[model samples]
Target: MATKEFKLPDVGEGVAEGELVNWLVSPGDTVTEDQPVAEVETDKALVEVPSPYDGTVKELLAEEGEMVPVGDVIITFEVGEEAPEGGSEEAEAGTEAEAEAESESEAAPAEESAESAESAESAESAAPAPGSGRVFAPPSARRLARELGVDIGAVQGSGQSGRITEADVREHAESGGGEASESAGPKDVEVGTRPSATTKRGEESASAAAGGAEEGGAAPSGVEAAGRDRTLAAPATRRVAEEEGVDVDDVPTDELREGEAFVDEAQVRQYADAVKRAKAAEAEAATEAEPSGAEPSAAESGAESGAAAESGAEPETIPYRGVRRTIGEQMQQSKYTAPHVTHHDTATIDDLVETRTELKERAAERDVKLTYLPFVLKAVVAALKEHRHLNSELREDDDEIVLKSEYNVGIAVATDAGLMVPVVDDVDQKGLLEIAAEVNDLASRARDRSLSREEMQGGTFTVTNFGAVGGEYATPIINYPETAILGLGAIEKRPAVKEVDDGGFMDDDGPSEQVVPAHTLPLSLSIDHRVVDGADAARFTNRVIELLENPQLLLLE
Candidate 1:
């Protein structure tokens, strides 16, 4: 047998360390090469490490939840007979033997045993029961057993071949003797009988603090304790509540006590309404507290209002340590370095809509549904080909511009967590239906956060659809490194001019001719002025509108 050390590998863009999220193997377990042995979470994504060699696990050098640097030895394997050795195996074995001997010698005295009567009694006390041998149990299960005063030796472990687990303890407790609930009741009863002097003093101090806070016109101290209850919720749940203006503390906890599992949607809405009312009341009170006086000067009032706003606002502090941090730095670099200008336009899409409707029916036969995004993407790509500057990037160091031949378009998709742009590569070569399918797949992956770093990188341009949210026009910020970004607004039907036969304005009946209104889509194009002038931007915008207005032109190379 021989030993081999497996070190952590670089898994991200220059990541130096990763936190060990989980270990899939234990000591003495046999593993095959390329089998996942551990999961490590870096700043970018969760990565799984595969076993480099097929062998029996000798030891795990790093514990789960511990952060290990790249190139550090994380696990050791005991190689089998078929394993290859590069050097003299005997010499390595001799060195390992000496080290093990030294370690054992150092540990022997601390674990020394005796055979006398007192020693025998101690040995007996430490020994296992008649039929039960040493049992493997998790720390949580052991803690639960101790709390419940349950003898682990008497309880049969039902987890993975008699190993004790948290679930086992919970099951036992639910069966009326395992641990949690049963232990809690008796512990509380016992605590009620004999209150500790320290607890009494703490209670007294808390009461005094609460009184002092109230007297000083500050919020009561108990309010802080109550606020801790809100911290127990998941971040997404908290965010939903905050967005809807819900006060979590005011929500009824009866469901939680009854073990109803999840927070009901109706309860969340009710709490949100309550929070809104409370905020309204607070704002009213603040307004009433203002002193009556002659109006101050505009500048002075503005300054005072700004100061008040700053004082009342809570600063949002986020640790710069993940994908979001990377995005933030990149966006800041792009915004400050690039000089941006925007142009807006509207296009009548009555023919385009009709074409889309016809294409959608045909597309369903091929298991693809035509969407407006694909048409828009195709139009953008076509326009980019005509306006080459839009597909170019500027170099700051040499003061040179490089025009890219490939058209990689990034579609901005909004998610519950934040915004993510997943790139669609070589859009110029892809058809409208193909682009739509790819856009759907990328957007889905983005929302699920399953997109790879490569899928998000190398975008030459970006498109953000504010139309879904009912926005008519918006000055969108250019996605950093990309020279321009296009914003799509909501499409609405409105009256438009139509051609009549025989070059006449009215029908043959002498009554005024009429036509159904067309759907108009609004577009806002934001460009980097450093790379493109207003005239170029206007021309590009006009080209994009031209393609959109005439859908047939979008299919052009």
Candidate 2:
């Protein structure tokens, strides 16, 4: 039977790795295409990774509860064989062949490497090294060569498929490999410094010589190495190791060839998890061993604990994991990435409250629960139309401001797990009732942990009503990528001066103003200062207030 390996796939945008929550299948079990084989938790949400092949499971490469990077082989499958799949006898034969091939491919024979070294030196002539024309190398290798004052384009590649490895560049530099004329007065390439035009052409010519074929695109057997000790791993493996702050060499592996370990993301993840668990165990032991005051009876201790809890002397500890960790990371990123400026204002929303009261029965007739959120959503969308900058994202990398034509507002919902912002798409196209229904549905699902990842994504802007829980105003962090967030405070009745039309119930005898109760709504607007100024923020707030105060204008929308 031919065996195939399955690698973890990227489940979300920019997700480099995920925690393997559980495995749905076991060894020798048959699984078909599109069948979920594993559940993974990324920074956003829980994702199920489905199988891509129809075959019998041969082995699970990764342990559960480990964080596996994208493109790491998590499992292996055996298929197209009638022989019984159980026991090591059959598995041993299959794995042995696989291991042998892996060893040979990773480390070449010493004699062959020496021969390759000699061939590389001999190939260097007045023109250039034969394989040096198109030296495929990583940016780090190029940077190293430049720092060492070596001509990268003149060095022969000694990596798999003729890709110029970093070791190859260093070796070429030590051997003083370069044109005699250029080597006499070589220039150092500093970091972030641009290379000369002639050097740029040389680098381009070297790449062009291979007809622009992708690096490592050629057959592995076609290339030769020169006794270079390099780690054999995919890019994803290296990326994960870097992200976890672990050296790839430190990761232990049983698949050894020539005393060299072939490291992948799974090995790195296992090492990282072991380190974390060790730290946690050490901390727990320390806490337990610490002596307390004279031990009390069980009843007394319980009463003491209860008193401590009631007096707020002891605080409850909550482990930050899963959704809580996700929220923390996102909040940290947003707070640090954006320079936030907050504008606070309050509007007399007596008109809005009256209009909502008027529409309550009409909305109930259609079996819809209408609230102030729909009016707020519609007003926000209308205001966004007038002030587009608040409804846009700053793409600093592309040096462009993205103004969204469609309104997709995210409503932040507080839940037991954490805060979740579910986006309501095409808000401008939906009526008040439709928007209210969607908001209710999204919030309900969010609280119950039934909201999908997609439902929480693609928000052009965000609206957080902290008023529901009794907050007047807050400086909410910009919800990343998006430039702004609007916070609605609690609505309350306050005394205000009003002009008397008939002068019938005024304290003054004739033509007087009166202090009367009016509904007031407080608003807090926070925006990214890099893309928006104070003036723009004020104008946006004004527009939203205008739309709410003049609820009749919403009919035209």
Candidate 3:
């Protein structure tokens, strides 16, 4: 047959080896070209290897549970009628070795037949002369008969063709007189006295009879000749019985093996008792071995008390790896690289709330929901337009600030793992509904860890909604490579005065009717002082709050 050797192929970049997970074909099985012959598991993913030739499998060169290098021969196949001639010197040597093995096997049976004939002829010539009354028996039986001082021909044979077997010779010796009956002895004997030869033989007969009775009757009844009862169990049940300190052979396996190898209620109780005893011993040993002066440390005691106060608390630790690791490194680089200054302020949002409520009702008809985030984002975009310095970037090589006209805002979304900021490109060109939808999509993708690297990079400014999680105010760190980030806090309802057309003073006291409205969300701006001064940050925060409070100004922008 034409044999083809299949070599392992490179699966992926820099992967030198792969684990052979399973083999699909065995020796003598036929396989077609491009058919999956094996599955390999690499570090990243599982892959399949296909046959290179259509042929019957000749040999498997690599065994399962073995590591093979790439390009090694994994399998060989017999392809056609004619075997290929040796193409290399190594192939010729392998052929010679196969020929030598075949010759050895063919010679072994002939030599065994010759040896058997020689042994039979030697045995016939070695036989004793006639009248010696010797019997034909195996060498082992003859040796045994000599040791017992018994004549072979006198003993009855129970082997093939009436030949004397070892067992038959033993039986004849044990009977003490063969076919010739001897005289009996007295039935009674004194204590500690040695019995006569005849008495011993009679006693042996009685013992054999008793043993036969016990084997036929008592054993099947689960009772021994000594009146002790035992149970029957399977191998697995026997193992459990040993561990549980139960006598497996004495226990009835009927209940334990009823369609399944399961222990009954009594066995379960017995196991529990053994386990309890073992636990009690362990506890006692531990109590004895404990040092008298051993005590909890102050920190440990405090932590224990704290844990008791919060009974159901579960502590978690997350490794800063992958995206989170990148975030940590970037944040650290920003904090040390850029000198940051934070400015915070709160504005009256009564007008903004009223305007948003009016816009929301209209937005519903357009299949959109106006939220505070969009209003803040719109305000931040407008502020960027007004103060170009806030939207500026610093050049490290030239040590000069480069201000850009286009505004691209990135919103930071906090997730269970860490922070991710996805940018909204060209925010100035989008309308309110478009901005809202884009912001929603970005934030949702950021939270779900589906944002691409491009979506996360290239931004002029960033806004973080700390207020969503109950924080009143926070000076968010600047997402460096950019100038600033805005932090929004929770809004609360407070009493404030409004300009009345009638020119009357409105107080909290019932005299004029003060307007109790939801105030504007507090905003904190942290900017790179190297690029923009405190005045520039304050102006940017004021402009953002103004747009948030009077959201109608966003449409004008």
Candidate 4:
């Protein structure tokens, strides 16, 4: 086989290098052309790199979390072909012969293993009994079996093609067939042996209740005693239970796979939810059982306060990595490099709000979701056409300003992972409904981390709605080469002065009009002072305000 190296391609605009976030393929795995092999995160976005050759992965040159430069060999593939070099033809022939001999020698053990697996499968098919033979399971299933200290060969295969599955391994462990030391249950718990001074009586009551149901006797109130086997749960599930102050042993499980108890994170969450509901129901029942306007005794209130005080608080620290680190670095760079000047203003969006309310039902009938963002985007694009500097970039190296003719506006989406800006292309050409649908789809995909590299790039400008999170105004950083960014604050209702018209019928002798409530929107525009003047920023914001106040003007475009 001939070996070939695959280089990392540039994923972002002018991006020289990228961080290798994950590898989808491992060595010895066969890959097809155009198959996603690795996920690379550049300064601009996260993207998947596809395999260019149809071959088996021989080596991964870059490890996960490592930054690899463009044009570097990230992976090696072995194609099914003879060596290209003829420098040592005889030596190559000798090497091939030696490899064949080694393969023949290895084939005997492989054949023996296959035969043993077949015998085990036949025994299992005839009767569900433990067999002494080799196991046939996927790598993941085998790893999980080892972690549980179960004998995979003795477990019955319940998967297609007679292969052992993870469920089978879990079942074997639950059946008490695995090493006793590896199995965990409530009986073996050693934690919380020394009762804390602040430990609540409710826990003891719950444990006593559990003991009575299981052992036919009440457990001690103060300290717990080691009784039965420990609860079988994954490490992660146990951690979650501990964090929530729930005893893992008391968590009941009806999820039986092949008669083996399976307790997963979902089961734990459901149990917690059930407990909360039960407590709420008991409280309500007690409240209804009490006399009208009855107050709790001072002693009862003091005990509740004491219990609350006993619950300790700990600070949590999350490591900065992945998307969070990238966001921080970019923000720092933008703040330091650009001289940002922010202009704050307010726009009365009562007309735009009413128009949206009117068209909402019609949009819904056509399976389209109409949102205020579409109107905002339409208004912003119209304003950008008149004030071109906001949509342009400052080329510091060339000492010039580059105004973009095409309108590609990026909408900032805050996700659990980090902040992701998914660009909406040609906003100037698309109608309001089209822009709304596209924004919704893009934002949805961004939160799910399914947005492609191309979907996030090529933005001429950016618009961030800090208002979504209840913020009134923020000086949003320019999306690095872009000249300016528009921050939308929370749309709120406030008192406004009502004008009495002289030409109207009620103006001459009727009661004077007073201040009334009106819907208002806050706008904060941050511009690169080097590229755009203060007047330009003010003019652009005013135009956006005009379009939003009178949305009918958007139809003129």
Query: Candidate 4, residues 394-429: lDDT per residue as tens digits?
Result: 888899889999999999987545799999999999
Global lDDT of each model? Answer: 0.60, 0.64, 0.56, 0.65
Model 2 Cα lDDT, one tens digit per residue, 477-508: 98998999999887877777766666555445
Q: Model 4, residue 521: displacement in angstroms?
A: 1.1
Clashes of each: 2, 0, 4, 8
**On a 0 to 100 scale, what is the lDDT of residue 91 in model 2?**
48
Q: Who wins the lDDT comparison?
A: 4
Error of 2 at 333 (Å): 3.3
**After superposition, candidate 1 runs with Cα above 4 Å error:** 1-5, 19-32, 41-45, 53-68, 74-319, 415-418, 448-452, 469-471, 492-518
lDDT of 2: 0.64
Model 2 misplaced regions, further than 4 Å:
1-10, 20-39, 48-66, 69-323, 450-452, 500-512
Clash list (residue pairs), candidate 2:
none
Superposing all C-alpha atoms, what RMSD in Å does each candidate have to the true structure?
A: 18.7, 26.8, 34.1, 17.2
Q: Candidate 3 lDDT, tens digit per residue, 173-279?
A: 78882322231211222211233444332322322221111212322221212221333222223334444443433322222211222233244224323333333
lDDT, candidate 1, 447-534, per-residue tens: 4344556787899999988776667789888887778999988777867665546444555655454575878888899999999888
Candidate 3 lDDT score at position 30? 69
- The all-Cα superposition gives candidate 3 an RMSD in Å to the true structure of 34.1
